[model samples]
Target: MLKDVFVVAATSFVALPALAQTCAFTMECYETEACQDTSFALTAELDDSKLVTDFGDLTVVGVKRDAPLITVFATGEGAEYLLSRNGDTARFTAHSNDGPTAITYLGTCEGEF
Candidate 1:
Protein backbone atom coordinates (compact mmCIF):
# COMPACT_ATOMS: atom_id res chain seq x y z
CA MET A 1 0.00 0.00 0.00
CA LEU A 2 2.83 2.42 0.77
CA LYS A 3 4.50 1.64 -2.53
CA ASP A 4 1.25 2.23 -4.39
CA VAL A 5 0.79 5.55 -2.70
CA PHE A 6 4.32 6.60 -3.63
CA VAL A 7 3.73 5.54 -7.22
CA VAL A 8 0.55 7.56 -7.47
CA ALA A 9 2.15 10.62 -5.92
CA ALA A 10 5.17 10.40 -8.15
CA THR A 11 3.05 9.96 -11.25
CA SER A 12 0.98 13.00 -10.48
CA PHE A 13 4.03 15.07 -9.80
CA VAL A 14 5.65 14.10 -13.07
CA ALA A 15 2.48 14.65 -15.07
CA LEU A 16 1.72 18.10 -13.76
CA PRO A 17 4.53 19.77 -15.64
CA ALA A 18 3.64 18.08 -18.88
CA LEU A 19 0.01 19.03 -18.57
CA ALA A 20 0.89 22.65 -17.87
CA GLN A 21 3.16 22.83 -20.85
CA THR A 22 0.84 21.59 -23.58
CA CYS A 23 -1.43 23.97 -25.47
CA ALA A 24 -2.90 24.55 -28.92
CA PHE A 25 -4.15 27.59 -30.76
CA THR A 26 -4.92 29.16 -34.08
CA MET A 27 -3.19 32.44 -34.82
CA GLU A 28 -3.23 35.22 -37.35
CA CYS A 29 0.31 36.27 -38.04
CA TYR A 30 1.04 39.80 -39.20
CA GLU A 31 4.27 39.99 -41.09
CA THR A 32 6.00 43.33 -41.23
CA GLU A 33 7.59 43.38 -44.65
CA ALA A 34 4.88 41.40 -46.32
CA CYS A 35 2.21 43.74 -45.13
CA GLN A 36 -0.25 40.91 -44.86
CA ASP A 37 -1.74 38.68 -42.28
CA THR A 38 -1.83 34.93 -42.45
CA SER A 39 -3.52 32.38 -40.28
CA PHE A 40 -2.04 29.18 -39.00
CA ALA A 41 -2.55 26.62 -36.32
CA LEU A 42 0.20 26.33 -33.76
CA THR A 43 0.75 23.82 -31.04
CA ALA A 44 3.29 24.47 -28.35
CA GLU A 45 4.77 21.98 -25.96
CA LEU A 46 6.78 23.62 -23.25
CA ASP A 47 8.31 21.51 -20.58
CA ASP A 48 10.63 22.54 -17.79
CA SER A 49 13.54 21.87 -20.08
CA LYS A 50 12.52 22.77 -23.64
CA LEU A 51 9.92 24.44 -25.83
CA VAL A 52 8.73 22.96 -29.11
CA THR A 53 6.62 24.57 -31.80
CA ASP A 54 5.48 24.10 -35.37
CA PHE A 55 7.76 26.53 -37.18
CA GLY A 56 10.88 25.80 -35.17
CA ASP A 57 12.03 24.60 -31.80
CA LEU A 58 13.59 26.58 -29.00
CA THR A 59 15.17 25.99 -25.69
CA VAL A 60 13.13 27.08 -22.75
CA VAL A 61 14.94 30.11 -21.40
CA GLY A 62 12.35 31.20 -18.90
CA VAL A 63 8.78 30.43 -18.00
CA LYS A 64 6.20 31.84 -15.65
CA ARG A 65 3.78 29.03 -14.92
CA ASP A 66 1.53 31.39 -13.03
CA ALA A 67 1.29 34.05 -15.72
CA PRO A 68 1.70 31.25 -18.29
CA LEU A 69 4.24 33.15 -20.33
CA ILE A 70 7.20 31.51 -21.96
CA THR A 71 10.35 32.93 -23.45
CA VAL A 72 12.17 30.63 -25.78
CA PHE A 73 15.28 30.97 -27.94
CA ALA A 74 16.43 29.07 -30.96
CA THR A 75 19.65 27.15 -30.87
CA GLY A 76 21.89 29.10 -33.27
CA GLU A 77 19.67 31.10 -35.63
CA GLY A 78 19.26 34.21 -33.49
CA ALA A 79 15.54 33.80 -33.37
CA GLU A 80 13.15 33.99 -30.47
CA TYR A 81 9.46 33.53 -29.80
CA LEU A 82 7.36 34.59 -26.87
CA LEU A 83 4.12 32.86 -25.98
CA SER A 84 1.71 34.22 -23.43
CA ARG A 85 -1.65 32.82 -22.52
CA ASN A 86 -4.49 34.40 -20.61
CA GLY A 87 -7.64 32.37 -20.30
CA ASP A 88 -8.74 31.42 -23.79
CA THR A 89 -6.67 34.10 -25.46
CA ALA A 90 -3.02 33.93 -26.31
CA ARG A 91 -0.44 36.14 -27.97
CA PHE A 92 2.62 35.05 -29.83
CA THR A 93 5.52 36.98 -31.25
CA ALA A 94 8.24 35.63 -33.49
CA HIS A 95 11.40 37.58 -34.06
CA SER A 96 13.10 37.30 -37.37
CA ASN A 97 16.62 36.13 -37.93
CA ASP A 98 17.25 39.19 -40.07
CA GLY A 99 17.48 42.77 -39.01
CA PRO A 100 14.04 43.98 -37.96
CA THR A 101 11.38 41.71 -39.34
CA ALA A 102 9.19 40.62 -36.50
CA ILE A 103 5.84 38.92 -36.73
CA THR A 104 3.12 39.28 -34.17
CA TYR A 105 0.38 36.73 -33.86
CA LEU A 106 -2.88 37.02 -32.02
CA GLY A 107 -4.59 33.78 -31.28
CA THR A 108 -7.34 32.00 -29.41
CA CYS A 109 -6.60 28.93 -27.42
CA GLU A 110 -8.24 25.91 -28.97
CA GLY A 111 -7.65 23.54 -26.12
CA GLU A 112 -5.06 22.20 -23.77
CA PHE A 113 -4.24 18.53 -23.73
Candidate 2:
Protein backbone atom coordinates (compact mmCIF):
# COMPACT_ATOMS: atom_id res chain seq x y z
CA MET A 1 0.00 0.00 0.00
CA LEU A 2 2.87 2.36 0.83
CA LYS A 3 4.52 1.64 -2.51
CA ASP A 4 1.26 2.30 -4.38
CA VAL A 5 0.78 5.54 -2.49
CA PHE A 6 4.29 6.64 -3.39
CA VAL A 7 3.65 5.87 -7.06
CA VAL A 8 0.48 7.89 -7.03
CA ALA A 9 2.21 10.82 -5.37
CA ALA A 10 5.00 10.70 -7.93
CA THR A 11 2.50 10.67 -10.76
CA SER A 12 0.67 13.62 -9.28
CA PHE A 13 3.92 15.53 -8.94
CA VAL A 14 4.81 14.85 -12.54
CA ALA A 15 1.37 15.61 -13.88
CA LEU A 16 0.85 18.83 -11.97
CA PRO A 17 3.40 20.69 -14.02
CA ALA A 18 1.82 19.46 -17.22
CA LEU A 19 -1.60 20.46 -16.01
CA ALA A 20 -0.28 24.02 -15.39
CA GLN A 21 1.14 24.09 -18.88
CA THR A 22 1.13 27.27 -20.95
CA CYS A 23 0.98 27.84 -24.67
CA ALA A 24 3.83 29.14 -26.79
CA PHE A 25 3.84 31.56 -29.73
CA THR A 26 6.13 33.08 -32.31
CA MET A 27 6.07 36.47 -34.06
CA GLU A 28 8.24 38.28 -36.58
CA CYS A 29 8.93 41.93 -35.93
CA TYR A 30 10.84 44.63 -37.75
CA GLU A 31 11.02 48.36 -37.23
CA THR A 32 13.52 51.13 -37.94
CA GLU A 33 15.16 51.06 -34.52
CA ALA A 34 15.17 47.24 -34.33
CA CYS A 35 14.88 44.44 -36.85
CA GLN A 36 14.56 40.71 -36.37
CA ASP A 37 15.05 38.52 -39.42
CA THR A 38 14.77 35.26 -37.57
CA SER A 39 11.64 34.12 -35.79
CA PHE A 40 11.76 33.07 -32.15
CA ALA A 41 9.34 31.12 -30.02
CA LEU A 42 8.17 31.89 -26.52
CA THR A 43 5.59 30.60 -24.10
CA ALA A 44 2.25 32.32 -23.91
CA GLU A 45 -1.27 31.85 -22.64
CA LEU A 46 -4.74 33.22 -23.32
CA ASP A 47 -4.94 34.46 -19.76
CA ASP A 48 -2.29 36.65 -18.06
CA SER A 49 -0.59 36.58 -21.40
CA LYS A 50 3.12 35.98 -20.95
CA LEU A 51 5.36 35.80 -24.05
CA VAL A 52 9.05 35.21 -24.56
CA THR A 53 10.98 36.51 -27.60
CA ASP A 54 14.70 36.29 -28.15
CA PHE A 55 16.74 36.67 -31.31
CA GLY A 56 20.24 35.35 -30.99
CA ASP A 57 22.79 37.63 -32.71
CA LEU A 58 19.98 38.93 -34.92
CA THR A 59 19.12 42.57 -35.58
CA VAL A 60 16.49 43.76 -33.15
CA VAL A 61 15.21 47.11 -31.98
CA GLY A 62 15.61 46.78 -28.26
CA VAL A 63 17.42 45.21 -25.32
CA LYS A 64 16.28 43.01 -22.48
CA ARG A 65 17.45 42.88 -18.91
CA ASP A 66 16.81 39.17 -18.96
CA ALA A 67 17.80 36.75 -21.69
CA PRO A 68 14.15 36.22 -22.65
CA LEU A 69 10.98 38.21 -22.22
CA ILE A 70 7.61 38.82 -23.82
CA THR A 71 6.22 41.82 -25.70
CA VAL A 72 2.88 42.87 -27.14
CA PHE A 73 1.93 43.30 -30.78
CA ALA A 74 -0.97 44.46 -32.87
CA THR A 75 -2.52 43.72 -36.26
CA GLY A 76 -4.09 45.94 -38.94
CA GLU A 77 -4.92 49.56 -38.40
CA GLY A 78 -6.49 50.55 -35.08
CA ALA A 79 -6.21 47.03 -33.85
CA GLU A 80 -5.68 46.89 -30.12
CA TYR A 81 -2.68 44.98 -28.83
CA LEU A 82 -3.99 41.87 -27.15
CA LEU A 83 -2.87 39.95 -24.08
CA SER A 84 -4.58 36.98 -22.55
CA ARG A 85 -5.85 36.22 -19.07
CA ASN A 86 -7.92 33.23 -18.11
CA GLY A 87 -10.62 34.05 -20.66
CA ASP A 88 -10.04 37.77 -20.09
CA THR A 89 -8.44 39.97 -22.74
CA ALA A 90 -6.22 43.00 -22.36
CA ARG A 91 -5.11 45.49 -24.95
CA PHE A 92 -1.91 47.52 -25.13
CA THR A 93 -0.38 50.18 -27.34
CA ALA A 94 3.10 51.20 -28.35
CA HIS A 95 3.55 54.41 -26.49
CA SER A 96 7.10 55.05 -27.62
CA ASN A 97 10.23 53.43 -28.93
CA ASP A 98 12.20 54.62 -25.91
CA GLY A 99 10.80 52.21 -23.33
CA PRO A 100 9.79 48.54 -23.28
CA THR A 101 6.68 49.74 -25.12
CA ALA A 102 3.88 51.20 -23.14
CA ILE A 103 1.08 48.79 -22.28
CA THR A 104 -2.21 50.30 -21.24
CA TYR A 105 -3.88 47.63 -19.19
CA LEU A 106 -7.47 47.18 -20.30
CA GLY A 107 -9.60 45.69 -17.59
CA THR A 108 -10.89 42.12 -17.49
CA CYS A 109 -13.75 41.02 -19.73
CA GLU A 110 -17.24 40.32 -18.47
CA GLY A 111 -20.66 39.22 -19.74
CA GLU A 112 -21.22 35.79 -21.16
CA PHE A 113 -24.17 33.68 -22.23
lDDT of 1 by residue, 53-111 (tens): 66655665666656554343433257677777776677777686787567776766644
User: How high a TM-score does candidate 1 get?
Assistant: 0.58
Best by TM-score: 1
Tens-digit lDDT track of model 2 for 38-99: 32232332232333324221112322222223333433222334333344332223344454
The CA lDDT of each predicted structure is: 0.59, 0.34
Q: Candidate 1, which ten residues in sequence have the lowest lDDT sum?
A: 67-76
For model 1, the superposed segments whose C-alpha errors exceed 4 Å read: 1-17, 20-37, 65-76, 110-113
> Quick one: best lDDT, which candidate?
1
